[model samples]
Target: MWRDLLPIGRHRGSGGYRRFAWTAADTDCRAWFKAQAEARGLSFELDRNGNQWAWLGDPLAGDAVVTGSHLDSVPDGGAFDGPLGVVSSFAALDELRRRGAEFARPLAITNFGDEEGARFGLACVGSRLAAGQLTVDKAHELRDADGVSLPEAMERAGQDPGTIGPDPERLARIGAFVELHVEQGRALDLSGDPVGIASAIWPHGRWRFDFHGEANHAGTTSLEDRRDPMLSYAATVLAARQQARLAGALATFGKIAVEPNGVNAIPSLVRGWLDSRAADQGTLDTVIAGIEAAAHEHADRDGIDLSITRESFTPVVEFQHALRDELAKLLGGAIPVLGTGAGHDAGILSASAPTAMLFVRNPTGISHSPAEYAAEDDCVAGVVALADVLEGLACR
Candidate 1:
């Protein structure tokens, strides 16, 4: 399974995956998922929001034990971030069947769409829609870098956007949802464990900062006469780093756009997106407030009009204690329990159902890049751990 998926969306130059939502690479991934489901004789399903599901036993059965993760990637993302959980899901099922496990409840594996939000700037769109955290009207307003609407993208990929909305009935049928993923940080690696359980997700959000100023010829305009939004933007970026450091949080301006982008011309507008996270809500709020105040100060000094818009925000998600404890008990009491700054579909689904996550060891703790990786032995350990958890949960 890993070999079949390794080359699907890999870029030659960067050696990273580009499986953005509803793109050709994403299509290939969806097809691969369908084929895997069919080969395993699991009933295949595509939910209203384009999430893929493969089921064992009855579809209408209540209290279904569902496992799996998304397959999409961020821009030039690593292979393991999303795909690891999905591949591990299939492998775990195979392991369970080999062990001759008898299921007491229906089981399903899922591939939630647009998990990375690399295209639409909203993470966990599939799960959020199903959980009703995102409204239909707001969903219709989502657009990509190229001005492609979310509904249009779904339609182009052969999914009915009209049906995209909350599916409480489907969510209600799920008794428990477990997502196995490669650890985005070094918690497991530092603890010398191959697998660990997630305790909570940090409060995180993305905010867009737009600084508007005058455009002029870079070579001709005097430094004192020029009203440069770029100057204000740069100052704000520095301030963000400083504020995050003081607050002991995380803040990054990873994406930006400049109007009339040219080397010889001053930009009229500079838009930068800030991604910030903290272990708690109050700390995150404080950090964001500090950064925004700094941005305002810089913009005011530079005579630049400033506007800040929150693109997305997710509060801290504490996983269900019962399920989390159960997973730890199944994996043996010696396993580590840790919290993470990164967000996942498991966090989004936690609002609607009992959700938990297992993290595989990542030696370097690098993610969302080509260098992200997990050792082969660690990956196999993850699969076995997931199989054990599923057996304990579903096989009784």
Candidate 2:
């Protein structure tokens, strides 16, 4: 069903979509969401933190049922990560309405901002700020590669910077949250299932490593004299792979940049962003330590200085037991249950409210790339499962 919707706001010209938060494309997706919600007679409102909420019943202050996902993406992320939940949210609402299902508590769908960390580099920015899990000063201090602060960026987009944190009143409004998303990994395909309920979210964090080396002329510098940061970075990358494999955790040197990137010169100051995830905090720490050891060793060998910065850290989280049990019963106890390595706004929101997630199978076992995929039948199936869960939660 989304194949037709795929190309609507897709970007990077043959790569994929670029709906980073607060940008034109992201705003366009919001417009699309508003149109869909309006068709269902839902009302849209902006909370203090700028998270968009579309309500489905009479306005009440406390504990409303909520569903939906972020609309932001990495530069070339696939179509399904964030928007799937938003669209399928409407789809599920439509399905329930057709079934004549009614709710005692109000229901709303939310579009959390900057879930991708693509534009802001902090995961689940909106939800974290709204929930008070993160400080507003830290939120305002977050900077992009080009040095634009989040506060300045928000002001540029017509949103108030002072209103960006810990909306206790807003947090109190949500009773439960369920996000439907594409499986970012191969868990579901191996189970041979079209849909599964999430069991837990793996512990994950982001670290930035800075390597400083001499910048010198390629022709004049001898091999022994050249202190190339790129060489140290390459060594660190290899060490990260080896250490993670040895520790049985997932570590990636996914994003890297070198200053003065000239082919004719030995580069100075290569940077690496390491994303390490594992089943628990211990393993995550082990993996990170291993990478740091690699950095120290390489820095000494290459005659470079190194520094590490922690961008964000999220511990593993378990879904609410009673709510998950209710969903399991609705699915006939046949639905697959699995843990995800990927992070989401729901994961951040789960601490304060009952939160759960539904994952659609991806045949390719790929995500965050152009090749990430989900079959149409599987998408419709996700909508069905979500509708079923919503029905149980709303009418109960």
Candidate 3:
């Protein structure tokens, strides 16, 4: 399964995946998922919100034990971030069948669409829509950098956007949802464990900061006479780093766009997106406030106008204690329980159903890049751990 998927969306130059939503690469991934389901003789399904499912038992059966994760990637993302969980899901099922496990409840594996939000700028769009955290009207308003609307993108991909909305009944049918993922950090590695259980997800958000100033020729404009938004933007970046360090949070200006993007021209507007997270809400709020204050001060001093808009925000999510404890108990109480600053579909679905996550060891703790990785033995451990959990949860 991993070999079949390794080449799908990989870029030659960067050696990273670019499986953005609604694109041809994403199309190939969806096809692969369908093929996997069919090969396993699982009943395949595509939910209204574009999520794919493969069922091993009755579709209408209540209290279904569902597992799996998304297959999309961020810009030049690593191979393991999303696909690891999905591949592990299939492998776990195979392991369970080999053990001749007798199921007490229906079981399903899922591939939630647009999970990374590389195209739409909103993470977990598919899961959020199903959970009703995102409204239909707002979903229709989402557009990409190339001016492609979400519905239009779905239409181009041969999916019905009209049916995109909350499905409480579908969510209600799920008794428990477990997502196994490669750890984004080194928690498991540091603890000398191959797999661990997620306790909570930190509060996190993305904010867009726009600095407006007069555009001019870079060569002709004097240092004192030019109103450069880039200057204000640069200062704000430093301030963000400083404030986050002080508050023990995380902040990054990962994406940016500049008007008149030329080496010879001073930018008229600098638009930067800030990704921030903290262990708790109060710390996150304080860090963002400090960063915003610093941005305003720099903009005011530079005679530039500044505006900030929150693109997305997810509060801290504590995994269901019962489910989390059950996973630990099934894993023999040796696995460590840890919290993360990263967000996942498990966090988004936690409000609608009992949700938990398992993290595989990452030696370098690197993610969202080509360098992200998990050792082969650690991956096998993760699959075995997932198989054990599923057996405990769904087997008679």
Pairing residues by index, what is the TM-score of model 3?
A: 0.99
List the candidate 1 regions with Cα displacement exceeding 4 Å. Answer: none
- Residue 380, candidate 3: C-alpha displacement in angstroms: 0.9
Give candidate 2's whole-model lDDT. Answer: 0.86
Instruction: Compute each candidate's TM-score over C-alphas.
Output: 0.99, 0.96, 0.99
Candidate 3, clashing residue pairs?
Answer: none
Which residue pairs collide, candidate 1?
A: none
Weakest lDDT window of 10 consecutive positions for candidate 3: 182-191
Residue-by-residue lDDT tens digits, candidate 2, 175-284: 88899999998888898999999999999999998999999999999999998988888998998898889888898988988988898989888998989899888988
Clashes per candidate, residues 3 or more apart or on different chains = 0, 0, 0
lDDT of 2 at 92: 89
Instruction: Using lDDT, rank the candidates from best to worst.
Output: 3, 1, 2
lDDT (Cα atoms) of all candidates against the true structure: 0.96, 0.86, 0.96
| Tens-digit per-residue lDDT, 186-234, candidate 1 | 9888889999999999999999999999999999999999899999999
